[model samples]
Target: MAKREVRETSELRAIVDSCQTVRVGAVDEEGMFIVPMSFGYDWELDESGTPRLTLWLHSAGAGRKAAAFGANGNAGVDVAIEMDCEDGVITGPYACSYSFAYRSIMGTGRIYPIASGEDKVYGLTRIMEHMAPGAPQALGPGVLDRTAVWRIDVARFTGKQRQPKA
Candidate 1:
């Protein structure tokens, strides 16, 4: 079994879409911290029509994760993100021949808090759409104020996977 790199943008997006959570990693005065959170994603086209990926995350209004995201400042913090879907294991004649099948996307980006109320609503909407599609998509009063919404503009990302032998 061998690991293969998924180089196409569509393929990378597919991998991300298949995953439920994203692990965000950051560093603070104490040390490095990583947390897994529910996420939503979107893709935009640049001037050259290249696809750009942005991830949305939410949490309580106050916490270590919010601080690491530069909640109080306009400047954002650097973050590393990873998301994967386990595809199950493959059995072979011998232990050495077995391999796991999975697809993963890993990247680094800048995470910033969405300060505006409207933008926070937008982020929350995306998250709800992804996590609970077909459910009520309405936001009640004070929901935006109580929740912390974050936007991660992916600078660069790559996808990789190992497949079970046929």
Candidate 2:
């Protein structure tokens, strides 16, 4: 596989931090499926002043991700950040479409399955906090009992953006 590419550093981290959900792309023997998923960021700096960002995602006992990893351990993913563009040039028979603002992060990495109970709970809590920051959060008593957290250890990620010029 070819090496991952990053157009800019600051732009990549900024978009990832601001965006809520990312479309995780994976392919299986059946076909390719792009899943819109949420993640938690573990942003820190390395000794050399490089930004280290990690995304945490979870799933129930058995889910599509499980099958995707089973099919290919070396699977990768692509995440996208889009804008809610209102009042666009209504073209064609459809209402409107906006491809003006977009930032996508794509890379190759191996998905690490969570085996520890603590890690699973932590991942789940992160998800809850992300979804409803102020709302009263309550996961059923048996959520962790049945849930399994799968963290995507993104080996390398880069951002591609399209924005208006000054």
> How well is each residue in 65-129 modelled by candidate 1, as lDDT tens digits?
78778744778888999999999898889999788899999899999888899899889888988
For candidate 2, the C-alpha RMSD (Å) to the true structure equals 5.8
TM-score of 1: 0.91
- Our tally of clashes for model 2 stands at 0
Pairs that collide in candidate 2 are: none
TM-score of each: 0.91, 0.69
- Top candidate by lDDT: 1
Candidate 1 segments whose C-alpha is farther than 4 A from its true place? 1-3
For residue 107, give model 1's deviation from the true position in Å. 0.4
Per-residue lDDT for 1-166 in model 2, tens only? Answer: 2233345567677767667776667666677777777776566778986766666777665766666754433343333222121222323445464234455566655555666788877776677676667776566787767766667666666666555433
Leading candidate by TM-score: 1
